[model samples]
Target: MNERRTPAVAPAALDDIDRALINALQGDFPLAQRPFADVGARLGLAEEEVLARLQRLLDARVLTRFGPMFQIERIGGAFCLAAMSVPDATFDRVAAQVNDFPEVAHNYRRGHALNMWFVLATERPDGIADCARRIETATGLPVFLFPKEREYFVEMKLEA
Candidate 1:
């Protein structure tokens, strides 16, 4: 029998350099095969130490994910943040279907008329529209697309 994997959510409270390191890494990680080597140099720690700390944080579920963010337009891909007015009664079922797509990066239920919102990223630009259509067909609810018209940068820092 296989164990089920559930969402890993942890309360935040990091200590000393661990907290500082997480905040520092909130910015761009080096675009190199040995990223920890570069990061370790800047943080005045050995690469192995940096790797171990990061592994510990991951094990504790303090960091959900860490990696690169690509420019979808430059790559000829498509991405968007979308929402649907899902009825409270069927929200979980509908959300499960939405999350079933590999393209969905994240999904959440928000307190609004359009309750279920999610981020979608597709390999082909044309696929975005078709994906929305397919989701609508499956859920029987219109998905409102919020494609990026302009670029915006939002930074979140994990503090101790």
Candidate 2:
């Protein structure tokens, strides 16, 4: 009964400028008063243009997310990968309830027994378990937490 749902938004077309902007953003973003301007400068675009394009892309769902990735563990925070076996009939409602928790970084749907997967980020190490318990209480489902044993870094960039 696991069914894949199509994305609500249509795919967005990318032009050369959008491609260059995406590539440029993958590098070290400037730490300055006007970071967007700095990025625009590198791409030979005006600051306003850069902002507009970025906004448009986000609104069009071209980019699901745009922000810095933080190592929560470094700052005394914790992250855990969690999964649940959500019934097909109530999957969307369960997803909405899960996402209502600010601690959930993101959620995904997989075609498996543990079909609903998400990451929980908490300010304290113990908060992972607390959040999971709260989610279980809210959704009336069991949550499986997979804490990190070791870490590996992988840097990847793709042509736009």
Candidate 3:
């Protein structure tokens, strides 16, 4: 079995409620105008405390992004992962073009045959191929599209 290794971050400084808030907010937040207050009440904390801790967490970069994951298909949106064999000579320029698109959520340089990879989410299914074409034109390199054939559910929990 092959296991991918992820670097361990030094434990972040946090309080009891901060830790508890991390655990509680992992699954889902309550759907309400005062969502933080609702979450705080359930976790036995004040709304301001919950909000403050979340802000701290954000500032610390412990959470890269926190938002809703939409049912893209149902919502008439399309998504895919793509890679490019970006040569070292022009990687920076190519990467800039790839990242220029508003549809690109995030891109990373991986050490592999397909060195540059990114996830693209767009308004329609056709946008996947269109974005690939646009990227190719902008970067002057062939972009390979690798759409997900199946979905894998990943569960992660942090205990600090």
Task: Estimate, for each residue in 5-120, the C-alpha lDDT of model 3 and write its tens digit.
Answer: 11235546887877788888877778899998999999888999888888878767566567777769788988899888988787777777788898886677778888887888
lDDT per residue as tens, model 2, 1-160:
3332324666789999998998887758899999999999998999999999999887886765688888989999999999999998888999888888999966888989999988999999999999999999999999999998998888777677
Candidate 3: clashing pairs of residues: none
Clashing pairs in 1: none
Pairwise TM-score winner, candidates 2 and 3: 2
Q: Which has the greatest lDDT?
A: 2
Candidate ranking under lDDT, highest first, comes to 2, 1, 3
User: Which candidate order results from sorting by TM-score in descending order?
Assistant: 2, 3, 1
Give candidate 1's error at residue 131 in angstroms: 1.6
Provide the lowest-lDDT 10-residue window in model 2.
Answer: 1-10
Top-TM-score structure, candidate number: 2
131 in model 3: Cα distance from truth in Å? 1.7
Assess every candidate by TM-score.
Answer: 0.75, 0.91, 0.76
Candidate 3: 10-residue stretch with minimal lDDT: 1-10
lDDT by residue (tens digit), candidate 1, 1-160: 1111224355546677787678768877788889898888888888998888888887776765677788887888999998999888887778788888878866777778888788889989888888999999999999999988988877766564
- Report how far off residue 114 is in candidate 1 (Å): 0.4
